[model samples]
Target: MNTTQELTLFDNESEVELFKHKITLEKIKNELINFGLTSNQSKVFIYLGKYGSKTASEIAKALQLPRTETYHLVNSLQNMGLVTAELSHPTKYTSLEMKKAIATLVKQEQQRIEYLAGKEESLSQMWNELPFFVVETDESKSEKMQLLHGLAAITNKIKEMVGSSTENIRVFGSMADVLRLYHSDVFDWIDNAPTELKMVISPMTKKPEFVSDLDQDKIRSLVSGSDKKCFVINDSKEILIFMRNANHPTRQTFAWWSDSETLVEMMSMLFDLSWEKGEMV
Candidate 1:
């Protein structure tokens, strides 16, 4: 091969080697993170392991980290037994041997797990000892409404309603609303629940595959299109209604829950009328 061809071939080979190095470094960094090092700590540990002992200044300069931050990282790594410092005028940090470092991390994690396990029984006992009380008054007998924000709060409310329902449950919504419940694992709770369940979906929605696990007799599609409003009624007593668009992102989703006798009765009646108009799935 001519000189130009040789240089071109060498360049390609160097590029391939550089790519391989990057992948390897990334894998190492991820493993270190899993082993309990922060990203910066992993970077410092890997740099020390790869290039041998380095002063904090050298490390900070090479890694483009602040000098103070580099020292903190070195100190943290030393505390974790992943890095050590040489006793010299200017201390140099060195990484523990890869095998030994990993072993140390594993041992530390096992100890932590065992410690937590030992505390579990006592923690449970202490938790159980705490009494929960609600004082009853004239105001306590009045109907209540609660505004729930975000998907997490809404999901927990659904779980509570499903778990508490012993008689019947009714759901009405668009495809997007049904999909939100399905993705949130609410259907799993419903499927396992002993309570009777009746679901009504908008006419615009095709029957989803998740309904197959449910009793088809209990599933229905509305005779006419409806808006994206979604709600659940538990035992003709409590109700949770989505206050915002069900198709909105989880953070933007909002819901209102009520145990008002009048509101529940109205919603339950509406659900029954809609149910009557729905075609069986």
Candidate 2:
């Protein structure tokens, strides 16, 4: 057709094709980066993917990277199961099928989850052993009190208090709050521990299914009246109070825990008065 187009030499046509191939290589490299490969690693992988197989030197020269760096990238890709290397003269590396490579990554992630699940108990024990960094005035540690927030923090404090009880554990709360603890197996921990439990459920709330299963001699229900607030006194050692607005549209709850003997003694006296009015279950 056109005279200038017809006169184009072989070298010119080959250069144009090389330029288009480079553009394609850049797109493939970006996709590989998103798939979790490092930049250099992605470059090497795409090279092998598109060019079939390549020796480390060939890859280094084609990508204009140092030969030693190319070897490192290839080794990392092989370890990730994205590439495979053959033991031959000037060994060649080739990428696995994209689907198979991604499948391998997924498998590794699932294994990590299982491993963490297996170590959860030991991990929790280690976490609890770490000291809390609190800045406080000069006072006996046994007389210290800490404000707790979030459901998780409150639950942990309750478990710790219950576990440390030597004589008795007193609980006062609504049937709904009791049911939450029961479903979470807090009762199982209480039952296994060497502590007596006395619970006072609000008059507005009904008994839960696990009520009958509890120790009757230690259980009680508030007959006159009770509020939605909850508290736990672990003998004379500690007291945990949960202040809540049950009917509030926001359904907010907050808790406080203290080892202060003065504060705990006051709570214990209140618990005694409530115990006297409660109907034994």
RMSD of each: 9.3, 14.8
Give the per-residue lDDT of model 2 (tens digit) for 1-281: 23332222112355344454555666666666656688888877766776678899878877678999998999999889889989888899999987887788788768887999999999999999999998775653446778876565677788887788778888877776677667757778788889888887765346566798988778777755655677888988888887652332121456778787888899888878777887876
Which whole-number lDDT from 0 to 100 does residue 116 have in model 1? 100
Q: Write the per-residue lDDT of candidate 1 for residues 1-281, one digit (tens) a residue.
A: 33333223213344433344666777788778867899889888887887789899988876778999999999999999999999986999999999999999999999998999999999999999999687988987988999999888998999999999998788899888888888899878977888888888885456667778788898888756866779999997899999875777676899999999999999989889888888887
TM-scores for every predicted model: 0.56, 0.50
Output the TM-score of candidate 2.
Answer: 0.50
Worst 10 residues of 1 by lDDT: 3-12
- lDDT assessment of candidate 1: 0.84
What lDDT score is found at residue 221 in candidate 2? 79
- For candidate 1, the TM-score is 0.56
